[model samples]
Target chain A: MKRLIFCLAVLVLALAARPAPLFAQAGGPLRLEITEGVIEPMPIAVAPFLSGTANAGELAARISAVVVADLAGSGLFRAIPAEAQIAQVTSFDAPVRFADWKAINAQALVTGTVERTGADRVAVSFRLFDVFAGAPLGDGMRFEASEASWRRLAHKVADTVYQRLTGEPGYFDSRIAFVSETGPKNARRKRLALMDQDGANLRYLTGDMSIVLAPRFSPDGRQILYTSYESGLPRAYLLDLETLGQRPIDNQAGVATFAPRFSPDGLQVVYSLERGGNTDIHITSLVTGQTQRLTETPAIETAPDFSPDGRQIVFESDRSGTQQIYVMPAAGGPAQRISAGQGRYGTPVWSPRGDRIAFTKQQAGRFHIGVMRTDGTGERLLTASFLDEGPSWAPNGRLLIFTRVSQGEAGAPSLYTVDVTGRNLRAIATPDFASDPTWSPLLP
Target chain B: MPIRRSILTVAMLGLLAACGQNAPYGNTPPPGFGGGVPTDAVDVSVFGAGVTDTVLFPVDTWELTDAATATLTAQAAWFTRNPQATAVIEGHADERGTREYNIGLSARRANSVVEFLVLNGVAPSRLTTIPYGKDRPLEICSDEACYARNRRAVTVVAGSVDLGS
Candidate 1:
């Protein structure tokens, strides 16, 4: 009996001496899947970066604030206010007090260190931790860039942290192209404006010499396709971002073309062309300067958008006596009407994931932003307003940015964003009235 | 309501002028004469002389109405009178549809006017169509009357107008 007991004890000790199974440890990494969609933002705490250099303290605070703002603005992560922090982090290398964070209901924590490397260069290093799991989510990453690019560095940090937590890529580093409006409603001066996703770095791509509308970015973010009324006729123009050079899109002498979007491959553009009292969808190859009619109907057909695979096209048409969504072959074929709702539907944009389509719906004298499945089922209205139109999806297909026009003479159009789940509706800050926002793909 | 309001204003002004000229004092309008003003009291000159500059259309349609055809016929005659001038037909839509789709609809509406003018013996070269969609509106109000005023095609006679703004 004694010998058997001794053997059993030795076996137990041997098993205990070995490391716990990969996921059987007291605290292992936690993976959060945003598949079903998260309505409540996970509470996160961002500790001020540790810095010991000339003006490093101020810069560090600013960097951390930006990081917090980026994550909070996403609607997937909520930053716990500094007053809610239970413990302060003074050293980047210090072990995280998971217990303290857990007490404040912080599901995630971020700690970082910032240092001045050169006269005008700084380095930011950060690590994200899952408080409940008591383990670092991903390896720490350090980004070095000029001081002038501090905001971008901050966005990069937030993006990395977001990707680690959400299991999806981040769009914090992306840009938006929109129409900036000023003056009164009757004589509004609208200019094409470009800015960061967070509304930073406001730049006007066109002066107020003429009205511009519907600015769309190429997949590579190197060019923009927009409609200009410079010639007193709405025509699409392709503007190269690098040179600010633009040329008129190819069209027949009497045909007016507008509502342009780049194909997934960025080698072609799909737009609407109006000729002889009839409007239809057309696809134009950017390389060969060739154009093909995609839709040929007496009813108005416009707002053509290509599927991510560039195999199909979805657009808005009024063939049935009311506006509705339609899908057709990319090369042109008989279109299948998708939207079956009572009211008018338009601005059908295929989601990046290709599983859903977002659109602007006008029903019973109310405007709404809604989404539906590819085959037109599972319709969901995400927002309602006096005037809400022009939905542009984030690259991840998780969020949408659109325009909302207020009511009355003081009513002006502005940009607003909402998650695909129809939560976190917030107005995007702009210098003035902004509309027709389109999101660029993730930065290279 | 907006159309009625404009007509009433014009009628009231006409009544005041008649009183000033004949009675030289405030006087009640004669029973039949007060409401005798024609429903079409809206003077064609309000839309610009010789050219009925504005032709309205029904919602989400580019089909020419009988009234619209009448207006376009008058416009064609005006273009015939003014040979040196070129006509730019500006098509507009009410702010009830999507911007891009409205652009398409406006184009169709403008083209309809162009076709009607051509049918009426107006040279195609003398008329060019421009689809402003809902970007420019004759009325910015959201009511039905305002929307009706907005869904229109206006023919502007430009005498060497520089359209390249």
Candidate 2:
């Protein structure tokens, strides 16, 4: 028996010593996991693509520049300037000089080539390399689009590069709809404005004839639901982005409806309706024009937002004697309060990843922009100031854009974006004071 | 001559007292634009000018405070004097809370005012509530004083009396 036991022990030790066959380490490239929280931006070098034709050279350079900007704006990767590059990528299929990148301490290298496919058409092919591993990070890919869509093609390349490194979707191709404010502080003129996620290609969807508020995009990014005070009463209006056409909702004559948001499926809109001195959340189906009251409580219930899966809704309610965040079934049921902190939590928006909820909190006379787990744990305040309200999550769910107001009369609310980890707080440049920003999903 | 003048002055004073007693009050509609009161017109009286139109509330609470109740009580008296008048109660909040949540809070504040006025004999049908949240601010300052004024409910009267001013 002793001899048998010794043999079994030896077998077990040998099995442990050998690595698991299923967990075999592939020999290709070194990849880093881009987890939540702060870390030094990985240094990357994106070489200007070698154009297949002489006329495509300028277009190639422009595309490369856009890719650099998109990656830098993410606060995840720092692109080394062309002046810092030790080696030039003259050919698409040629091998990368790992030693040259190593000399510059670049962890990642990107090389691409562009070719003109037709009049107003182009094809962009790129590859990402792990400088240390001396191998391609993933399979190379090609994107084709019209020359007018060059910016979009560049955004696509950046998205793929970001996904290759971070293992997450990129929000570089998204858009935002916000209320643009100008004039004096009191009688400010506000119009609905839309722009690319990087604050380019700005377009005014509505004139300054009326006050617009809380413009939220549909899931497909083709339409927006906003509240306008055109009839001298706050009412919800649906605007089509492609046509720039709009119409008021069929709310009852005496009732005021506002704070509109699109349902996950974009088949209905959930908004607040004030009637007979009481405010309640009402869902109106776009197909049937049928309005259903979600909450009938005397306490005000507004700001209803849907979960990513459309199975649940997260909204704010004052039924508990104070403003608190709550989640309920999408079909309307008993709501569970998710915010337990002492502060007044409101404007609770569920993250696109369905992992967290972002909100604005007011406590002790100060306001803060914060995020919490879906179940109300792991609360983190990303920003605190005299005023920071109305947080809208980026399409990637990794960042939030909110309205931040300065102190005093001159302190108008401006658009600002912050990373989920409380770092990279930056202001989004707008021509005027902006507020109630809603980010669109990745463009088609 | 002194006795005749005293008699004429007493007669004039009696006539004035009778006119005051006969003025339209209670459930009777004022004799102006017939019985139909235009709902679209904005009447700034009952709660405007000499009368207090707005009652302020504390942060995050919709319950009427002592000061708010006092102002609304006077407002209720004005409503009593003008029974035919209808009102649109506009509720507002300061820039402290989320825009959507503040809408709810403002709705509650306006509802509280409506309830108090109803309990003080204002007809329920004569009031409509609209909550503007933090979208509309009476004072643009960011201090507590401005915020205090911002968190308010204003009763704008509407009736056949042509009280546009």
Candidate 3:
């Protein structure tokens, strides 16, 4: 009780210390309505959405919290606390009273209501309203789903608001599949992990039994392709997440495969094959398990990346006698060397825009983050560092997430992101070590 | 032209002899290259000036900058001066990229350097390349100042070269 009082006092003092109240007049739903078109972040309010007719078992609060959290976490909306909620909205179909919300300075409002459809099933509906504008931004959306899908409902609400306001797709509904790393640099322990975008509900897809690298999301969002060291041999495997099942993409030859990535259509898995001491890039059919050699001759052809339209692939090849990037048709043909003058370029990842390929280049002994158009032109190095590679795009294609390794007392890797403009560099928190990150498409 | 080439070759051989580990350094032997210099002593700290030259991209291209041709030209000259010193080009990426991609990129970087040297008259037999990516760093810190030092290709003489010793 004393602690509560002390915290309240501290908050009061701290808040008072500010030149003006950071949470003053415009911190409620009223501001949300008029502010929607203002281009600034619109303040909004989320009441614990009305619970379902079922038992709910604490999920009601959890679900409601998730919805608010998702919207707020995007650095977009300001979710006003329910503690100061002026009015209770019970029906998803009810007409909201804009005057009351606008008085609280909330320009927009998100109200959620759930109804039990079956024992484990429920119907969720959300209405986002612009208080000042006096109308819902989009048509009311309701979904018939399972209790576990409440999280998805949260994302949908955030997405709806995002689309309504920003005219861009929301990636809030996505998940990340990454190699969770532990141990030291020389002998590291790694596993495949899947987690919600906000780092919630983390689950290990692979046991820590063997080493794993580069877990990539399939187009369906229900599958992943990754390189595993099972059978004491490194190979690429396509895992059907729903079945908790696995299939080897290349088992007969049983060679070491590195840098496996999925085609944008999810029809193929392009990866590197190292057999009899020579490494090269290969493409395997997801359906037939049939494979085709993408590059031939001895030059360590590895790190294959595909353009978004699936017309061409940019990959690393030592064919010219050194490691540089070459662009080749997806149908398999002669490659034209694009990276002619760089020190060395590798890990060429084609952007979803189909215009640029992100790569790491080394020169004068330093590695840099660079990108170039599909024709191997307009190469611009974004960031310079000790080590930076693996540029995976943000769903909007505006940003990329890659790993940065800082060696000192701590010798390990961490995840980082940079605006494609090469500004606003920031780090994302990952438990333990993280690497080979492929961002999922915007969550439905 | 032939006399000049022969004289140049002989002078290079003499320079290797002066450096001590030259004969075994070049196409002479592989097993002899490793044992002498403590591989651990290979400094991961010194990457060249922050700018890397590539053949495809122009400058600062993590895409293997255009100057790569010229840098390799210079690196090839170094190899020419010390013929016996067979080199392993160690490629590294700065800390701004994904680790896996950087690793691959570094490998590509090192290979580009080796290729440039070979194309410019350095024997292909004299060069080996490996990409540490960002996994192994030359600089010890995470910031750009330190990162500039880490993104690099180190030409490690598989065998010790006599640095005029």
Candidate 4:
């Protein structure tokens, strides 16, 4: 008996001496596990879009509302309601009176002038001012857009102002490609709806063709990747904007696919596949259906995002006994836990800048928006409120925009934004409840 | 305010336990002072048994108030005494704004708490964060009071914060 026990103990010790497997060491050295959020929101103001007569098509009146919507939707600025706009500068050509704006306690101010250069051409020029410092921080390029391009022009203006204030590129001038809902949750009218970031200029790309979720924009803002319940099963689909083109990403079946995002170069799509009650992140080429599994985690893993270099992937998994962010090589290897905290974390989105990852965290029955360094250090929670999730980073990587839904009395879904510093809280303009927002990169 | 006071009282006791001094869990300060609210002890009658859609937030902004700050302060002190404790502070907002922006706003709220603890001498290495942009809820009520409560950061004990003392 003593001889047998000695042999068993020796065997156990040998097993324990082996190195940890490769799949367990993939996430880079930096990891940010956030444990707190800011108590106050920084204040900012977005001016109405400037307009003038001889307009391309109701030119002057429409742009202001669009600007308001863009700024508000970001949740980083407060659109000084036309009612409380301390002073209205008539045109971009006119000098701005910083005192008037500052008097209303506006920390930041925007002003613009619109000029009709020709029958089909209009130029819009805007300037952003720091109310606290009473100086012009930046000015936007003149947009000589046609009447039909008026809305886009306003977005560009807002984008410029946003970039100036937030010190990052603006996503306001971009578009939100989401599924427009017109029916009940069980049986919904699912169409690929493309609208301005402010919920204006709404158009349908996939005219009620299928049920879709997790719409992601192509890096250049030309196409989208979404999960469709078409063909009698859920699969990934890509839609082209210019021609309203549609193509099946892959013939995934038996197990459905969901939560898809494109690489920075648009060469690949990363998504989740439900196989026998377990989900894992998978990657496939845009040209060919050939796939490479990025996460071997047996537990559910969804919402995979690629690092800017496309060399690594950050995803959420329950391999650690709870849902948390994990990282592995883009080719799929050992996974490292980026989030090692208690509450469940999911919906991980890699920032465009590659310095951080944004994700949703649930703890003690509440959820929040948070970011952490690539290694999981410096974990900081940026926002907290009822039902805040689905973080989409602006092109600049300095600002984060996400959705907020109110339940019970003031229950409604709306968009909000904040800087990485946790300042500049504002709302985006919307006519109804909206969620699942994706920010587009700056247009050419 | 009185309810918040009650919450503060409980939070203080909880924070005290999480503090580096109070050894509720064990001797090696739990990771992050990552002390979390014991959901197992939540009363069904006061805050409701199951999760509801309702929440509460302060007026004009999403910042936690003085009372709220006091509660967090206690949490910070507890973090000082514990070494292994880790936590994820989650921020939230009411349903008044758009969803995308609220995610960032709520994240800022959570980050502030992390910053507070760090400023109070809590090690920055022990914290981790992730933001949930309006995907989860705590209450079913949508009134101002409910919204006030909803717009907050939940402390999540990650790793070995619960030492099973």
Candidate 5:
């Protein structure tokens, strides 16, 4: 992973310097309560950012477009089209025409400007305004970075705006590591690929020499753990994104290993290892390279995920004669079954917030992507299709991405995201057939 | 390539058996009968064509069926006539299950075949197992007909075998 480490020095300007009582107000700061019921998306206007320098015009427009797309893509906010705007932001420090925005039913507004600061560096600033309150929601801030990394600056601005309104961290700045597939279903060619959350900056991490499945990002977003058939058998390998170097997690030959995940602390990895005919979950210490068997069972046990706090682990197993979700101590112990539904369950992933577990369920010949409380209560299915599996949580735990394969001979797998409330279902655009999407933590 | 070689070998074996005993070497060759030919560097096709190389399994099952056992019995007899042969058993599954779980399931199926072969007089050291799960399907359709064929274990000849008496 080429770290896009931008020098985003926060240059707080004197404008909007007053710490307005946004959150301390009687009605609370502008918040979008994401519930299970239907929600009318909050209408907001993102004015085209003004260009401080002649060379910054195009970059300013591109940056503001990303901000608008990010906000609208969440399905919680609706971007008021630029054609409907009655007032324009002519300068960086221009006053907002609150009456004009209110007439367009724009409850919130965002205005920003971009300027060239150096030969290769640019500065971007933005302010979020509460159109209804006739005040700026928070202090206006500016970010400076290399001109090549303007997209990250735009995402950062979107993140700030999202945080101020929804009271949750933004996921737009994250990357996804997934298995990109092509060819036919019988002889599919799969390679590891990476991209921005919105499908920008697409790049392949590995060639199609061998089949790779389920690329998982490390907690720090610097490395990945995935299963590959490069050794002519399924085995887990740790890949350093920066160096593009990789090594098998276990050197023992003849045993198959797959379905790997990183511990929340990034010090260990839990994966499935098959010896002879039985499969069991095992944890390996990254620092010591020592492996310990976590689940000693003749039954199939795989797809292990660590809770955010690293105190517990959620996985799927067939010990009950049918696949179901289970929870056990992170150090290994007898697991308690958590699924009691009428279908088979597998690929259980713990939410980033540590409150729920997302999984894939098969019932009545239909597959569903679902979530439940950590203890297996409050079960809710988020998606249904011919085949839905491999649910990965966003960094904020507000959404999930999974693979959905259509039925039949020509069935192809694609990536889809849905809110935890079972709303905002949308497809992620990839260059080719894709699956096994794992979201990275917010970029540094 | 192996299939073509096996067909030629069978044809030559039939000619030799007919020349010697006035009978053709049938699909199930008699145990310990090498047909009076040097067995050095015998191709894997003989085992595949004459004794069968693959066995089908029920959905989500590793236990061998009665038909699978009969096939393995013939397989063991063929191995007895060729002691130097080593085999790799590939276990597979249908596309109805998750990827990782199917891997484990297919491993069990492959191990089941290996254990049966060992129990029926084949040397345990002569066998290795790999579980492909749903990754390698023989059929692409989603119906039961295709799935039944996909759920199988194949005993592929891996190393050189000396069939010479």
Candidate 6:
């Protein structure tokens, strides 16, 4: 029996080392497995965090609400309403009443506490329990941050709970950079904007003086790369978030450059340059300012994305007389077409896990947001609409957000998110029309 | 001489079409034609009157059709008549395509017009190009007619042009 248990432990470790599949459905008392079919949301109870200090009651409640909202919004967990709880968590260290939670059909229970740790500083701690097993699922943890960042603390706590249950990293603590649009479709004004993943902390990084498109976050999330028409022509610009300063990525006269994305290392930028009406992909070193042409075909080549390991680049091209997806070495070489199905494809974005590529396809008078394996197999269309394009992946590679424009005169573009399995389709709330959403890496 | 005669014939047809329709291109009448005082600087209205200032393209293509070529031929003649004027060609695409790809396609459309004008003896130094993609559409409908009107290149005569020069 001891040898058998040792073998099982080794097998679990080996599976963990491999890139996790679509869902981690490990056998556990509180497992919420998601298969190809309908997923029954797991019932979980998020007890309001206890306030350690007299003045922390309201903040503590708000934090708990955010945690509950995050889990419920994911569609994998069904948060039991606070009113439905049989008992309240009044203390942080007290043992959970497993029988009461089990009676309410809550497979998992979450409890936490909030306290004013210092001047303008707050501390949050949380613990997760398997109600059926009558034991804590993971060790309790605490996080400290500025009091103004209470929502982030809540996300971090929820992320910890999610990781412990799902065996996957949570994307709650990430941010998104997108374009906020206003005015008439004929003369719309666009500005770059950033917000937390849940649409909180909305802030505009650029004024509406110039049209901005496709704001992409660097791997470090401290800087943004986007296309702007400020110079009487479309060009790519790099904006530093800390200083709110921007500089053109390439400003050569008579050349229109746009669609810029940073390499995984954030040390190089890959973008398209239009010279005399020809668009091709080019990469420039940030440190050396040296630019190299990655593609030299007469056909249009744009929207280049680097793999997570920065070994290969996947981009869209029209060399085959129709738009299609192609993958090539990062150092520049012959590319192999990876999209073989009917219709046209563009805006190909490689998945963060390096297993799939998300793209926009147009066929038979309709547009679709789809994904395929790097080898071009397993093609699945996640969305079909009058106009849907530009798929940006979450840091965990489990979800995608793209733009969906309605049809006709009153049509406007909006941001929508969907799980990789094409489930849990939800629209992200923005103050104005939004598009080209790029998710930032998980916050440091 | 044959090109001049054809230009005159098309100019007459354009005037008839402008008078018989309610702005078929969806463009508001130029200042001088709409009862507003015309500025001394060359504008699209005066330069395009009786000669269309825009050329339309087929879907997802920048190749100049025969009608588009004829329109450019007329535009080149206008430039010759107003040698001191400069123009900025604006390229646009329909709403059916992606934003960045449309930008590229429109740029090609603008370049095609610029190349046509240069070949017709217009000075290359007097022209510039701006690809608007689908950001600006004259028609708001989602039908093919609206899309056809949106996919175009327009020669917007700049205010800096000195007619007296």
Error of 3 at A240 (Å): 2.3
Give the residue spans of candidate 6 off by over 4 A: A1-29, B1-42, B159-165
Give the runs in model 4 whose Cα sits over 4 Å from its true position: A1-58, A64-111, A127-140, A185-189, A207-209, A403-433, B1-165
Writing each residue's lDDT as its tens digit, candidate 6 over A1-444 gives 999999999988876664422222346545555544436677899988899887999999999999999998887789999999988888888778899999998878999899998999999998998887888887899999999899999999988888877777889999999999897776677899999999999999998866789989999999999998877788899999999999988757878899999999999999999987789999998888899999999888889999999999999888898888999999999999999899999999999988999999999999999999999999999999999999999988888999999998888999999989899999999999998899999998
Hey, what RMSD does candidate 3 come out at? 14.4
Residue-wise C-alpha lDDT for candidate 5, range B1-165, written one tens digit per residue = 566556545655554444342111112222334565433223335564565678899988989999999989988888887776677788889889888889999999999999999998998899987777787777788899999988988886634443332
Q: What is candidate 2's CAPRI-style docking category based on DockQ?
A: acceptable
Summarize candidate 3's per-residue lDDT along B1-165 as a digit string, tens digits.
556545544554454444342222112222224444333322221113442222222222334455555656665665676676676565667655444445455655666677667777888777765544444444455456666656666665543343331
Tens-digit lDDT track for model 3 on A1-444?
Answer: 999999999988876664421222343322222211222445788767776566653665676788877666555567888877787786556778778788788867888777777887877777777777677767778876786777877777777776665556667778877888876543356789887776777788887656677778887788888877564345678888878699877776535576788888898989887653356778988888898988777667777877888888888876675568888998779998888555878778887777788887877656677788877878888887766666777676656777676655365777777756575566777887887777888765
Off by over 4 Å in 2: A1-28, B1-49, B65-87, B113-127, B157-165
Which window of ten consecutive residues has the lowest lDDT sum in model 6 chain A? Answer: A18-27
Q: Please report how far candidate 2 places residue A102 from its true position, in Å.
A: 1.7
lDDT of 3 at B59: 20
Give the winner by DockQ: 6
lDDT of 1 by residue, A1-444 (tens): 999999999988876665421211244455445633455577889988778466788899999999999999987777999888979998898899899999998888999988899989999999988888888888999999999988888989998988887678888888999999987765567899999899998899887757689999999998999998875567899999888899877757767889999999999999988887688888889999998888878888899899999999999988998889999999999889999877999999999999999999999888999999999999999999889999999988889999999876577899999999898899999989998999999886
Models ranked on TM-score: 6, 5, 1, 2, 3, 4
CA lDDT scores, all candidates in order: 0.82, 0.81, 0.66, 0.63, 0.85, 0.85
lDDT digits (tens) for residues A236-320 of candidate 4: 7788879767787766545556678898899899987654334567888997779877666556577888899989988876666
Candidate 2's residue-wise lDDT over A1-444, tens digit each? Answer: 999999999988876665321111267345445545235677889988879776999999999999999998888888999999989988899888899998998888889988999999999999998887777888999999998888888889999988887778898888899999986665567899999888888889987756679999999999999988676567899999999898876558877788888888999888888776577888889999998888878777888899999898888888888888999888788999999988888888999999999999989888999999999999999999988988999999989999998888887989999999888888999988899999999999
Give the Å error, residue B18, model 6.
30
Per-residue lDDT over B82-130 for candidate 1, one digit per residue giving the tens place of the 0 to 100 score: 5544666778898887898888888888889989988888788888887
Give the DockQ (2 decimals) of all models. Answer: 0.25, 0.25, 0.07, 0.04, 0.30, 0.33
Candidate 3 has a TM-score of 0.63
- Kindly report which residue stretches of model 1 are placed more than 4 angstroms away from their true locations once superposed: A1-28, A35-37, B1-51, B160-165
Q: What does candidate 5's lDDT look like per residue over A184-268, in tens digits?
A: 7777778999999999999999987676899999999999999987776788999999999999998888899999899999999
TM-score of 6: 0.89
**lDDT for position A342 in model 3:** 51
Error of 5 at B155 (Å): 1.6
